[model samples]
Target: MTSFLPTDEEREFIEVAKGFALEKIRPIAREVEDNRIVNDKMVKELEELGFLSREMPEEWEGLELPLISQAQILQALSYGDLAVIQGLPGAGDAASFIRLQKDHPILSLHKEELIQSNKTIALLDLLEVANSQITIEKTENGWMIDGVSQPIRLASFADYVIVAAKDNEGVPVVLWVDIYQDQVKVDSGDYRLGLLASGTGKIIFDQVQISKQLALAEAEDAVKLMADTRNRIRVLQAAKQVGLMEAALDYATEYTAGRKAFGQEIAKFQGVSFRIADMAMETRIAAHLVWEAALAVDGGKNTAAGSSIRALYRAHRSLRFVTDSAVQLLGGHGYVQEYPVEKWMRDAQAQVTLYGRERELLIERGEQILSGAIGVTV
Candidate 1:
């Protein structure tokens, strides 16, 4: 991330995470993807090791580490396998948004359980107008939520799903629904291009009755919460992008350096070396921006249209370029699954499309800048 190096504790944590990745995730990466399931034992180990509690409150048995530390942990874990990292037991950014709202009704009662159990909470972003398929209605006893969520990440495995919707007056509201409730139905599993092991799926609420205890009242600063959640998810995704680019670059570099062409190493060729140099430059820039975004978030700065968003968009493009170049450098070998380059490209594409597409971020940031709402440097 910036020029700054990791502290002793951070370095130790990264090493432990790397060891786990090598020992647990790397061996099972192919098996997990083929079976479309993550290793339960490995996930349990991460939970017990406190890797899942990075951003939680300490009072509830959370680690509450700095954002940069959390970013680094996610990045290191992602280098092992993006799908496995996604499927890990932890309160993702969605749950983090609810947890930050001190007055959340449901979270108030179940906060401790959430932290102690390391339960994953899926978020359905009904705020996306293009995907505003869900709606909520207030009932006499609780709330009746009816609609379908399209391919929520980890939906099949989530202990809870925090739904974002609008009320009668079009005010945004969030609902905390129990995944096992009778009214909740998982329509189908996703067979996407990548991240199949992350348990992506569609969920349908057929007149689902949410108990009052499970409903989170609209927070006073719901807008801010939405912005912060978006920024944080982008930051986390950016971290994953950094790992992907770095791994791909390293793989390609090593391959070119050792492979002989025209009676000489491929890396010795000016064209080959220059392409690798470009990939390295982009990867470095992406990594630095990710850390800068994390730092900005940790510093309590707004990053909706700022560094966090910029970093996310830049990383998306950079990762895509790096992975593509890596595959090209590997030539025929990269197109096959025998090597990791193909898989790295797949993972990079997934990250590029997830959360928000690179184009969407660019357009939003462009509009904001042109409107004078945010400076160009932001």
Candidate 2:
């Protein structure tokens, strides 16, 4: 019964986002990446457009758009530049947690600041419990967070951080930390790959003591919340990847159609045309998977988590293929800095690394299916 067609309001929002992305975001993408920051003016514009608060609850002066609507809008915006969309100042990935637990006591305390200020929140998700350097220990009255986190988007400028990790005893917990009060240090790295405009950096927590009041959830509640939050994040991120894929696909198609090689347009050649067809197929597949995942999450289905994992894994795979195909199709011009295909290819790779490993996601989905936690249809 799920409909693929977007509602009138959703279509309007997508059109507006698409226009702003091409007109405003695409033009300054290089400048933003070069400066390693999204300027305040652009951030204000995004805020005015309600892009920054799309996932937040209406009670907190946010749009509280459904996952499907948000996914389409985000895909449209990110079509211009994924890094710029990521770098925009706002709640960042923590928006998913806020949307899931809108009325939590800890979140309620910060509701005013979140609604009134442009302060951003970075999420350090250590729930994977593999290849993580961050260590969490339960204390007498609270918990102590130590070690440095991997490069997380928005870490460089985040005013707050949400940690979703298991303690030394392996009890899952979610905690919020005030970056300034806790003296969390942002370790900026020499990132040359992609997402340069994103506030990508490591956060150092040297024996940071988080009181019990800051613990958003613990034990079973924390596990459930983290699962739902991660699913939502995966779906949204997959939507963004789909956007980048479409951008690369379209750019490559146009380049091939115009650039002459032998005696005519290169697109006339089978090699070039075949690759374009493949890129288009990959993009369409990724888009459909992301949309399905978004709808599953919005519907609060039991299979939502598995669907999200499948969507993201496919998105990661297809994004890399499509972007690389774009570069390959453009030949020499694709490798040069003057063209945007190279940047898109780099961004696609960086995005895949940051979100989740493709193999891991696939394995997780497989396990979910075998365990009967999610049906094969998902």
Best by TM-score: 2
261-377 per-residue lDDT for model 2 (tens digits): 779999999988988999999989988989999998889988798889988999999999999999999888999988999999999888988887888887788888898876787
List model 1 lDDT by residue over 1-378, tens digit each. Answer: 355478998999998887787788777888888877777788788887788777666666778777788878877877777777776655666646754664565676877777666677788766544545776777777678888877767777787888877754567767788888888888645566777677777888889887766656564455557766767777877887787787788889999999999999999999999999999999999888888888887777644348888889889889889999999999999999888888878877765665678778877788778877656786
Number of colliding residue pairs in each model: 0, 0
**C-alpha lDDT of candidate 1 relative to the true structure:** 0.77
Q: lDDT of all the models against the reference?
A: 0.77, 0.90
Off by over 4 Å in 1: 1-3, 138-143, 211-213, 303-305, 370-376
TM-score for candidate 2 = 0.97
- Candidate RMSDs in Å, in order, are 2.5, 1.2
